[model samples]
Target chain A: MDLSSINWLLLIAALMVGATPILLAAIGELVVERSGVLNLGVEGMMITGAICGFAVAVKTGSPALGFLGGALGGAVLSLVFGLLTQVFLSNQVATGLALTLFGLGLSALMGQSYVGIRPPATPKLDLGPLSDIPVLGPILFRHDPMIYISILIVALVWAVLFRTRAGLILRATGESAEAAHALGYRVIRIRLLAIACGGALAGLGGAYLSLVRVPQWTEGMTAGAGWIALALVVFASWRPWRVLIGAYLFGGLTVLQLNLQAAGMKMPVEYLSMSPYIITILVLVLISSGRGRISTSAPAALGRTFHAST
Target chain B: MLIRHLLAGAAMALTATGALAQDDGEPLKVGFVYVGPIGDGGWTYEHEQARLALVEEYGDRIETVYQESVPEGADAERVLTQMALSGTDLIFTTSFGYMDPTINVAQKFPDVNFEHATGYKRADNVATYSSRFYEGRAVIGHIAGKMTETNKIGYIASFPIPEVIRGINAAYIAASEANPDVEFNIVWAYTWFDPAKEADAAQALIEQGADVILQHTDSTAPLAAAEQAGGVVGFGQASDMAEYKPSPRVSSIIDNWAPYYIERVGAALDGTWESKDTWGGIDTGMVEIGEMTDAIPEDVRQEAQDLADSISSGEYHPFTGPLNYADGTEWLAEGETADDETLLGMDFYVEGIDAEIPN
Candidate 1:
């Protein structure tokens, strides 16, 4: 692998595009986790979004509306998760797993007719001469809208989580639902909204995959991207900016491994193919070894069903 | 436990119905298990097409059932068992990964006929069948050698299985035969049908200056990637991806299973079916080379067509040698051709390839 042979700018550009989907999904998941909810159905929601987005784009010839369709589809599916866990007080983990399975099957069935059909192209943002600035031009300015939106979403999420009164109350609910309930905050409503937001973002991630990345709809197209997002949230320690860095790192590794293979690196292909996941797990392990400090970062009431008693 | 009891009850019911059907002269029940969705437009799509052809040929005499996107391990065993219990007389397990499950299920249902695709395992009731896809690969490799400007050909291999290995060797051999300076860059996606991964692999290859891409994985993503990269060329694998014709997709390797499917089903109906391995190639019309689009120069296109014709006429062998392993070990002497045994268990990369075959 000659260093000179690699195009650093193009690699970074590919990294950003690769990271966008995971970053979007992870940020949404971070919000959901912050609101004391663990929705493991990110994969399910994303795939549902992929097919719904692809179907709408193909039907309406509008990639923008297709993104809306994707978000709506994901939010709707999250509503089912919200209903099952919040209304019926079911175990969040099992319910999330069921949701994933349900979403996969539903998407496959919905996508049957949409398969082999191409969706209208999602256009890139035009920055004119600014986009032509040598090394930074292609890396920063020449990406589809969702790539920029994903980073903006991260910034917005970081600000909202730390700087707003609503953020305080949401954190309070996550820290102690009974305390938030005593303070008269609608904990269930807040958690439900967070879950919906998470679903919508995950859906957008899925949409980015179908409309721009692979740019086609095939059954089970998400291909475990949702699970990767879920992992990213945990690795990011529930922080928005960390999630951005983690997603890029993971995405960069993915792209780099492929580049290495293309460069005819003598290492085993399986090792290179699996390096991204292995590295992610290692980072997670290192962070988790921080023990109480790391454990304290997770929402206290996460994955627990909230029940109001007399 | 609930599913088990339910399956048992269903099996009992199916047994009674099957006996009555025999008395009532009912149609033959055929079941298909696919590794990917039927709309994949490649490997699984071709199998589904063959299933449809079976229906069209037999009409009311045959009734078909299929479970799409079935995974290939314990889940496959469960699905195969369910089909067997449901009184499916002939089952086509269409994937290399379904070998063990097919064999295990065939053992339980001794009377039923089982045909597994691209697998080596077989039993008294199970038969293995696959197209000689390497034959098609050879023609495309020749085209790639001639068409490539960079003299670097990228291959997106699925798994390190013998079937895929054979294709890599065949393509590399033919490309080198045409252009001695042609170099191969291979990336294993480790999947049969993930479009996203396949696309990413193609992009990496294109970025590394490969102008011609070949894929053993089933998806149009590679061709789409090649199209996006503009000057890059590619060939459709397993099915004719003619949609991108005249550009990135200059040609394709089509798996034509209809005739084989029709003949096998006919044999089952005639009670003449027995366990056997079938590796049909271009000569048998099982593996076809799709149309060479105008993207290829007229002379080169003719050369590709001629190569296909020679393979079809059994006048040429893609694996003929004096060939050697990548490690410089002699594989075949002068005028020697690879036998079915060597091809079936191919594990080494032929000379000129630089990558290791992942275990």
Candidate 2:
């Protein structure tokens, strides 16, 4: 293996760009699951956001508005799930799966005209002299705004999920909807709000894919990234900070493996190709398994439908 | 076994009705199962274009239907079965992964004709066909080799199938011949149409000093990446991505399946369709070299064109003799050419590729 040829700084920078989409989606899903609502329609919402973001960006020649469109697109689709599972008290698992199917079909139809069009480029942040610094600048400050936004979202989610009264109510609603209802907390409303927040963030993640990452619109372009985001949330034990680490680790491993192969590494390519998933799961699962408290991490009332009368 | 027998019986009944319907002078049904979205702007897009050409050529006499993004394996089997059950007269299973599924479905629907692309397996009712993509690869390899300032060429490969492996070797052989110091950096993406992954692979290669990128995957994501990393050039695969012309996409290897599609459909209409294998190259125009842009030096463009012409005229074979496997074992003696069987099952890289063919 020609190890010397692989540039470590650029690889790290690419990892952040690569992981931003999954990180965005995972952070959102973390919020939704924390509220005890399990929405598996993340893939669907993401693709919807992707197409919406691409279309809006292309039409307006603005990447920022395109991201707004993507968030709105995801929120609209998630609201469909919210109405069905929240107000109607439908089964969360089945509804989420159906939402995914619906989202894929809907996006395909919506993206028919938008295919092959390029979105306005999402520019990297200009940190002036800071960006001109050596290794740290390239690895940290030279990324597009979404990378910083994703990290900021993670911090925001961490603070809100653990530090605020609202966070406590959201956690209580997730733990026991009946008790939260008795405490006069609007269980259904809180869960619905959480679901929307998750959807909007997932949409933002999808937009990052179309606007910055792949930077083009293709049908089913989101591929399975939405599913990977879902897995990230579970493996990170629903901790916002762990989600950040897992996303970078997963993203880093993906870019690193490709770099390894390009550098003529003789290791089995299959192992290298799958190393991201295997190592990410191993590391996150190991970290989350602390104190034999693995089973207690998930919200107790997750996937349970709540009716106010009950 | 019982379920199989029952399905055969149902299919036979359906076929008998289908045959009777055809006797009434109905439009011939031509169904297609694609491995990616038609808008992928690469492999499947080319296939979709040919499908449209088939419709236009036959006009109202032939009807075309297609399902895009159909995953291979069991899902392919299901789609093929559905097409057969729908009284389709001829079905085209596109993609190498559809080999077994096409064979399995062809057995159940004996009356329906099946054409499997880029696959070796064939039944009595299944016909196999593929373009000489390696011939096109040789032409592009020459350009890539001549154009590279870094002498490092990155190849974004999809799967490790024989088809993909063949392209890698052909390109590497021609590339190293053009510039003995040129190197290939191959990354197996293990996917056909994942834009994000393709982009990542391209960037990784570019960062590692590769100034030219080539992809076997069915997306323009790699070219897009090369465009973003200024000065990196690439060729469009399967289709002419004119949007990136004059720079990143200096040229393209276009897969022209329309003429073949028209011929096969004509045969089916005239009742002369039979199982066979067709591997047409530059001579028959199954594979075309798209217009080279000004980005390619004039002399290099002429050289690439001459190589393409010689291959088309049968004076030059991409797998000509004097070649050695990556292990330095003698693969072809002087003036020898690779036989169809060995080329079809190619699994190793040629000499100087500096990489392993991943399983």
Candidate 3:
């Protein structure tokens, strides 16, 4: 296949669009992981945010506040996870699963009238003359602001993780809650805040999905992007920049297949559709096999419950 | 054997559950398995609407129970079996994905009547039902043909499944008829009920200058995306998205399940239930026209309504004769309605489309 046949610009643009859903989700997951917690309910939280963002936007007709509402909605819901795992000291996995189940049921119940009704639209940012350039124009400059924000969040997360003392403390907590606790760090509070942050980011991702990306709320609307985001945190090996690359890689796969189909390539269309998901699973399995001392980058207590008595 | 015994045990447990729910004697029980949430405003929503209608019509005579957003897989089979085990005399598995599970479960409960939606499979105990969604597609495709300035139309497709594909082809046919120059851009979200993805797909389609957007998915997101595009417009799928007034939503095609649902359940309770393949369309009130919005011009709306009425009145058959396959070979002759067998087993794209069907 000639590379020329591929709309690299459109491919890249689609990749960016695809990444916004994952970027928003993975960043939230990263924070939750950084705090020595794993919230498998990213999809649930995102869908909840999707419905909330969708409902609020349709009700209020403001996309900006709609995103904020999504973030808040996600954060608030994630707090239930925080409270369950942190305060009540429940099994994190079980709690996360329940969080997803509860989120699905609650969102469905809430999304009844919101179904089929389009929420208020967010305007695409146009750089005018700059958007007219070949290749580069559509690729880089012409997406909704949330696209740029996702990339910014990645960089900001990187800066926080590698450059800041607070980042070190959070990392330490993820590595060993007991050690971090010994250092006078409030492990529970740190994890709680991290989860809340992750929740809000996930909510933003979901909001971006409903308000900007898809811009409508339907039941179970996140469509496994949240799961992809969870997988991305692992794919990125907990590194923020890697999340960017990983997110875009999978996102590109998603975009490329569709573009190929749209360009009218004579390939088994089902294979094209399944390619992204299959490739991700293979890449993930490959990565997990070679990475043994994953805790180097991984916080020690990721997915493990912390007990003060211990 | 394990499943049979389990189903038998489930029947016993269902008796207990039913006994618990009723605490009194009842002759009949009904349940619904929804693939999407009742609130999704598409297929599941339509099914739920029918369930509500059944409730309204039958009142307390028929005890209906429903579980929403059930996934289509082993879980689906389990849920269907449970509904039957729960002593539901009639069960409606409302999704194309539920076909196999419906059949699988129906085989176990020979006495129980099962109606599987949008599938070809059937058993003595099971029946198949679907709408001529393609017929609806033709009218909207015609409208999109008339309305689009870019000569480009976007279709938000749910899956590559035949049911959805047929609608895409039908829309293409009607669109091409209205304006021979119109080309379609399809965005397959590969989901049955993810509104966020559906909306994103719609947005991308609109960004590509598709002035008219259509959807095979069951959310209002496409119409919403069309609205958000500042000037782009679209049609409603499965439900009347009349909420988006003034612009974006021009008209809608509603899939009505109430009349059929009322009939089937009534039959079941009266001991007249039998399994058969049913493909209902405009004539049966199974597919109804939505409120014609002001967005459509007077003449155009009149023309669409006329075509709809003709179809309902049996004056037209959407898959009329003189058609060609994607390979440019003739499939049907002019003025000959494609036999039910051909339309039911449709696997090829019709003439005048650039899309290639993948095996």
Q: Could you tell which candidate, 1 or 3, scores higher by lDDT? A: 1
Whose TM-score is higher: candidate 1's or candidate 3's? 1
TM-score of each: 0.94, 0.94, 0.87
Between 2 and 3, whose lDDT is larger?
2
Instruction: Show model 2 residue runs off by greater than 4 Å.
Output: A279-291, B1-24
DockQ of 3: 0.37
Instruction: Choose 1 or 2, whichever is better by DockQ.
Output: 2
lDDT of 1 by residue, B225-279 (tens): 8887799999988888887887888999999999999999988877789999999
DockQ-based CAPRI category assigned to the predicted complex of candidate 1 = medium
Q: Write the per-residue lDDT of candidate 3 for residues A41-123, one digit (tens) a residue.
A: 89888888887887888888898888888898899999999999998899999999899888888878878777556567677
- Name the 10 consecutive residues with the lowest summed lDDT in model 3 chain B: B19-28
Which lDDT value does model 1 have at A287?
Answer: 66
**Top-DockQ structure, candidate number:** 2
TM-score of 2: 0.94
Please provide, for model 2 over B95-130, each residue's C-alpha lDDT reduced to its tens digit, 9 standing for 90 to 100: 888999999999899999999998888888999999
Q: Which pairs of residues clash in candidate 1, taking residues 3 or more apart in a chain or in different chains?
A: none
At residue B167, give the lDDT of candidate 1. Answer: 93
Compare candidates 2 and 3 on DockQ and give the better one: 2
State the DockQ of every prediction.
0.56, 0.72, 0.37
lDDT of 3 by residue, B135-214 (tens): 78778877889888889887877666667777888888888888989988766667666665566566556555678888
